[model samples]
Target: MFTPSSALTLEQGWQTTGATGSLQKLKKFNNQDFNHLRTSCLSQGVLFEDATFPAHVSSIGPNLLPEDKLRRIQWKRPTELQRNPYLIMDGVSRFDIMQGEIGDCWLLAAVGSLTLQKKFLENVLPKDQGFQDGYAGIFHFRFWQYGDWVDVVIDDRLPFLNGRYLSVQPRTSNEFWPSLLEKAYAKLRGSYQNLHGGYLSDALVDLTGGVQMAFSLKNPPPDLEEILKAADKSQCLMGCSTSGPLRRNIEVRNGIVQGHAYTVTGAVKICYKNGWKHIIRIWNPWGHGEWKGPWCDDSPQWDHVEPKCREALLRNKDDGEFWMSCENFQEQFSWLYICNNTPTFLDFGDQHCTKWSVDSHISLWSPVLATGRNYSPGAVSMNPQYFFKVPDYDPKPYNIVVSLMQKHAEDMHNAKTLKIGFLITMENSKVLEQFSRTRDITKYFTLSPGTYAVVPATTEDQEFEFLLRIFMKNQDYNENSNFPPSPVLPMDVPRQNQDRSYKAVFLRYTKQDSAIDASQLQQLLNDVILQDEMTSLGGRFSFDSCRGILALMDLNSNGRLTLQEFGRLWRSLTKYMDIFCKEDRNHSGFLDVSELKSAIQTAGLAANEQLLCLMALRYGDAARRIGFSDFVCCMLRLETMTNAFQNLAEGGSQVLMTAMEWLTLVMYT
Candidate 1:
């Protein structure tokens, strides 16, 4: 199985000085160091071959990789036999090293920066050749506030709960190392979580023992290069400098920056047609701050400010105090130091923010019409005939005012006074109360965006529809004048007594004819033909048989055959057969009575012998020669009778009477 013991090794030449101790004592004092060693050994075996790297590792940004060969690394799980037992990597700056969730990032960055400061990397790092080795005499790094650092003795055992050891299976234990590292960093930063709660500046302050500051993305100072160098040199405790006019006030009290602190993390380059622009990356140690500067290319401040504002503001070297960069800088000189950091140009391509708007209307009264001497009982037709068009503006809240008016017809001859009430519907659905008479109608109602109101007047005996007019006016407390004419269209009311002549004519025709017409009769014949064609064995003899038969019968070639045409064809064929053949006594080409009977028997209709006899009698001449017309008529009559009988059997005596009436009409017509 894969193990971490052979994966990473210390630098070739390094040494440690300390007495060896038992693993139990090491576990009691420093479990994190031991866990780190164990994880390293596990990583070696699990990730031995380049192609065996873990999926998560491969998924990291490939462009950021040190070499292309690392891309194809293979990963596997470590077995119990190949585990490691040490804490620190050899030949590295341990003082600056930090661990994140893997708890190593802070330490790593610190040590990485310190290694940049001095080339004595091997002196600070441990001397383990394999995955685990005891770093015996390295002095512990101390935090300024804590005043001292705790001794981190090497150990080989990890923390357990309820006196029970955790399972060392790779699947289960693989996550333990990273989690421990994360916890350590969280504790160092004084934050409980990664994304929230703690201050990022506080972590930096604790780690670096220096004052921290945050800058806005919108209005960053143009002299950022000077400020960043100053920060690196530890010249200013905290600074705020800009190349242009101050966008907002910096609220500092008692010579200290309060609430939160942040530090510059990285730089980004933004490119345009002419050249590239630089933007500094500032992170709030607390992880939250208001940087009222142009964060991205489309920042509004970027549009208003001049290109000179993107340059570094001049600073005074003699006093080392903060300075603001503006046209009136000489007059507003103060004892403060404002430093600008180095500019990092960002390549954030084609990103922008969009804005939209909304509008609304309020109703004066309910739209429901009440029953009275003059008003109708049903629902009032208060459908607004008007639409309110929203203007091109930003979404904001505004109040609407509605007025009510009632008028009575002044006629001495008519005794009753018209007492009409107004009902209103907002946005065509939200109903308001009815107002009977003119009152203080200027009632203010609040509305958001995308709303309109519909108002109508009605009385007790008759429901009258009215247009819902709308108007817009300024919201001023001192102004109490009439509003201007509404820009929206006037409401349209539909008349109740509109003409419907076509409907009346259709109803009259429907009442006159209840029987099936030519169209329906043809449909029934076609349905029967289709059913016969589908069910019979002979129907499958040819693919186009049904289509050919239908076409032949359709005299007009309009893709349909009428019942009259079908009946006529049957009659003509029967008549021709009867006229050409005499009654054949020997049952030859001409069918005699007995030969017809035998034919019926062979066709499985012998049980209806009486019907067969009647058919033969109807079709045959006095000389006993059968005619096609008579034969067709007899067959049609028998089929009609069978249908009538079946309907009667299922529907009882009433259907039987109806069938009789239908048959009589069919035969006579």
Candidate 2:
């Protein structure tokens, strides 16, 4: 019994071997290196960021330096650092000290979030330092989820809020301007790191924070006041409308809101260049919602709610806040609406047609045309034509069909006989289908206007070559010859180009009664011709090779070779020639009794010596003469060499002869 190796066991063995060759082969088969796997997973949505947990809060006490110590730390000497520092860079605050400045804030935030879960960071950080520690601050890290380990290099320069700023001078001041630093960091919000630029939303999400949304400033809904009136005590929603030219109206229905809206909860009063006024501050969670407020410098509502509402609303607004006015609200919100009431047609008439074709038959169907007009009896008629074309070498049949249409007013005078004629030619033969009548002849068909019909091709022979043609007759005029000429058009006929023509003929043959072993003879003839051709001496041969072989096989002259004749010819060539060799086995100038016995034994026919001798006597003259050529031919007539040889070994002389004949014929031919 054979035991198969388990893939897991084999892999474990490879891992234990620590062989570079085995690992390389494994990577090749898996189609990935560590870095490739890591990048692929990252591209598909893996995110990593440095997550800083408040040391004191998480029981990991005092992981970062005190404010004074942080201010005194030598930024230039990262290797000398004993504590971490928290700084606001870009728009967000992060704690991870990346060695090199990378523009990927989103990825950094994800890394940070993972750090919050201690296990994640622990799993990815390198375990061994070795010689890899000093050069380029290189460290090995694994993208644990992707099962990839890669080396990363850290640079000295740290990312500052405004730009990548080198810590040329370490500050020793105890009181540092953190606010100013925060402002500077905000200014660097959109800068590029490495090749990628920072996207705050992505970064926030990476940090395990919520994603930000975008909001557009637009006029509040018209039903704002109504919606406010219907507002329940629990529903703290109010609406406001943007003041501008009302380009369009949004319809509110069902429970969906048709237009954009935001929750508003703030107001402010300020003195402007024009005058003192009131302005409403709106917060679009999307982060950029500014209100063209009544509280602005020239607003008439300035004195009424500015100061009081300003503070109240300001307190209400936070990271995710919105604003609206009661006047612009709707009792119900809906995103769909009804526009103008115009007539529309739901049904399309008979403009479409379906067709299916298989083997030699092609079929088409056309339904009644429904053009949204009054219906009339027998308003449309269809006549379809099928065309067939055969490929140059392929023996399969190909076809196409065309449908023609005839209407009453189109041919008023000759309504009873719609005559459409098509010329036939070779090129158009393959176009198995076509439409006789089209709304636009130029666009649809290659027919000229008022031409009755256009010939598809240039040859009359091709037109008449069609195997089948049937005219679609209307029931009322089924038996009438004048009932519109068959809508099926013929292809165009081409002008005579050449006078050459050819014909095909057939022949037949019989089996047992045939004189020559047809199969063997044919093969022999082919071998002779091929050998001569190969030697460049074929031209010297008198007989036409193919003609001769066909004539020999066609024994009855009936234009066909029967199965019996084929089989007999095959068997003859493969069997029957050992007898001739019996007389000349020793080549002693004559056949001695001993030489004959040796020949019979060598041919594996010793047990049938009497039979062998009898056959030798019959084929050979009284002098027992056997020519070399006759001996070779006889040997070349065996049906199958292996079977004949087996029979000869069993003391069958006839079998030996048959086997020799088969082998000789096969080899020589």
Candidate 3:
């Protein structure tokens, strides 16, 4: 199974209001740090070229068409493409990206929808690096992969067909952000050909990392216009797609690209014939296609509108964006996908949309444990299960959105995919949904007050990875820092395996010595514990961490741990793990100050309010949450300090240690 990326998103924090998981940090693709490489290139006076994702034929993948074989594709930099290349000429608009030879309009459709978002567009595409001053031919873009947002970097060498650019083309001759952003995405998915055809929602989720819902236009819901208006007010990304063999991209006379994805930028009603007309603005990713029907750019329908209204609504340009009546939109399009980080437009009667809470969890489908629902119904019991509560604070039923997305390989088109689905079991009743090979499957439930178990499984027993996100309405994200301290109490940690292999493992690390130091202990611990468990247990113990452990457990003050001393340390570690897990309610691998206070108290140790604040400042991350490693270090220091003071104190609080003792304690821990 693919190991989840260790890079957690520091910018997009996990607000654990009603969510079960925290966001994982995003790592640089192939461990290539963009800033570091750019600096190296500048210092050396050379343009940067990414060796990891090199600009070669292999990066384009195999030829998939007859026309594709006719062109001699070569990688070209912006300086080679055009003179005075600007990353953004005028500001980024909705019509910047013009499609090229590739048929990945679905990808561009997603990007076009997000172009309407001016409030946080820079978050998705950071506009920091440009082709000027600090330019090193390197650019970076962030995309939401599965659950976490990952920053993908790429060189400026874009693939060119014959003499023109391949796949994505820039609007203006000098503007290159559109092409560069597309290149970054292509690098992320392995190749340009890998972007051939994909799910619109997949691209949408990657663009916004938000809740996505697709609606069929064939039977357009009565509240379709209402939903669009709400979505527009909520600043959601919306895309419309045409289906059927008739609309299957080959038919162009209707001015609609059949089987094509189009961005729904806005919804408006104009005063035409003194009647309200619901007009939906749909933009073609090709940057040219338009609906040749009613309310189209050059249609006579504009003559009936008020002059000012017509001026505001009509844009008689072949810039790929057009205004069409809702009736025409439903006739030409089959599906409309809407995505948003804040899902205020949902069916729930929510007065304040900000009150919603989202929970996310990432896990693997272990072959041994993932007993799927293929053979029998009861097999689902063996799948991994997660639970959440629906309190009875509101009398109305809450609208809950559950989304499951499978993680794919870098070459996603070639990656293994299984029929995956999830089961929601509540009140002894099981609710099952469609199981398909699609990347994302979402379901909506109007649930009352109760605890529910979400059991995600595949059609068979196999090893894979998936992300589960549950959005519950009315769950306020109350991350209060000044939580009341827990009273001094003790908690139980389940005893772990009692295997005799520890003796052999210990001797192997110590090499039959009576005792071992920090480095030896680190190696021994890392080797003995399984990697997955090690990850859950605050990652592998570092030499520095083990050194602190030695300081805490070395009764002789020698900065080494004897076998017997290691025994006590091991037991305490198991207890700390248990306490950490119990307090870390979101399973985010980190604990806030409130959780830290509870965890410290539960481990048969209590720090006053002042000490807890000090610990939070000392060990917590930017979000004021302490990671597992830091928590362990804090615990060891707390214990050692408490013991040293007690051992030399005349009163409970006063202690006087010798200079040598103080030096040794300060130097080791």
Q: Give the number of the best model, judged by TM-score.
A: 3
lDDT of 3 by residue, 558-613 (tens): 98887657756765665677787788888777888889878877866666666676
lDDT of 1 by residue, 235-277 (tens): 2223222222121223243221232222333333434336654
lDDT against the true structure, each candidate: 0.30, 0.26, 0.69
Choose 1 or 3, whichever is better by TM-score: 3
Return the clash pairs for model 3, or none.
7-25, 7-26, 8-24, 8-25, 9-25, 19-359, 247-258, 249-258
TM-score of 3: 0.67
Cα error of candidate 1 at position 332, Å:
30
* Top candidate (lDDT): 3
Per-residue CA lDDT of model 2 for 1-669, tens digit only, reads: 000000100000011111111111222211223345444435665422212111121211122224443343222212323143212223221222221222222233233333334333344343342122222221223321001122222222222323322211122111111211211122112112111322222222212211111111233333322222222111222222222112122323321122232233333234444564333333222222233333333334534554754445443322323332322222222111100001001001212221111111111222232111211222211122222222122111111222222222211321221222232223223212222221100111222111021122111111111111222112122343222222212111111211100000001111222233345444443443224222222122123433333344565876434443443333332222234234554443334344444544554443234544543453333666433333323233221344446766688455434544544444234
Q: Give the TM-score of candidate 2.
A: 0.17
RMSD of 3: 14.0
Model 3 is weakest, by summed lDDT over 10 consecutive residues, at 1-10
- The candidate with the higher lDDT, 2 or 3, is 3
lDDT of 3 at 321: 89
